[model samples]
Target: MGRLTDKVAVITGSGSGIGRQIALTYAREGAKIVVADFNEEGMDQTVSQLKEMGAEAI
Candidate 1:
């Protein structure tokens, strides 16, 4: 099992770049991931990706 399984996480500036990658990586490990960004469109895309990864961002 992943170390982050069932854990919750909040990531900022995750709409793009490193932050986004971090969020995705964490989610893949079974963590609840939150992607926050000033870019609305970027945010949407990231959120969508996270959802596909079986994670959710609030």
Candidate 2:
């Protein structure tokens, strides 16, 4: 199991770049994610990616 199993992380600026990478890592680590960003499209993209990884997100 991952270190973040059963955890939830709210990541700001997760639309792209470092923030996006962090969200992905956190999700991979078994954390549910709340991806927040000013860019709606970017946020949606991140959320979609998270979903593909079987991670919960909003």
Candidate 3:
């Protein structure tokens, strides 16, 4: 099991750059991810990537 299993993480500026990377890592660690960012496109991309990793994210 991952360290963050069953945890929920809200990441600001997760649309891109370091924020996006952090979101991905948290998701991989089994945390449910809530991505918040002004850039809709970037946020969508991050969510998509998380999904592909079999991680729950929004």
Question: How many backbone clashes does every candidate have?
Answer: 0, 0, 0
Pairing residues by index, what is the TM-score of model 1? Answer: 0.89
Ranking by lDDT: 3, 2, 1
* Model 1 poorest ten-residue lDDT run: 49-58
CA-RMSD of model 3: 0.5
Off by over 4 Å in 1: none
Question: Which residue pairs show collisions in model 2?
Answer: none
lDDT of 2: 0.96
Deviation of model 1 at 35, angstroms: 1.1
What overall lDDT, based on C-alpha atoms, would model 1 receive against the true structure? 0.87
CA RMSD per model (angstroms): 1.0, 0.5, 0.5
Candidates 1 and 3 compared: the better one by lDDT is 3
- Candidate 2 — which residues are off by over 4 angstroms? none
lDDT of each: 0.87, 0.96, 0.96
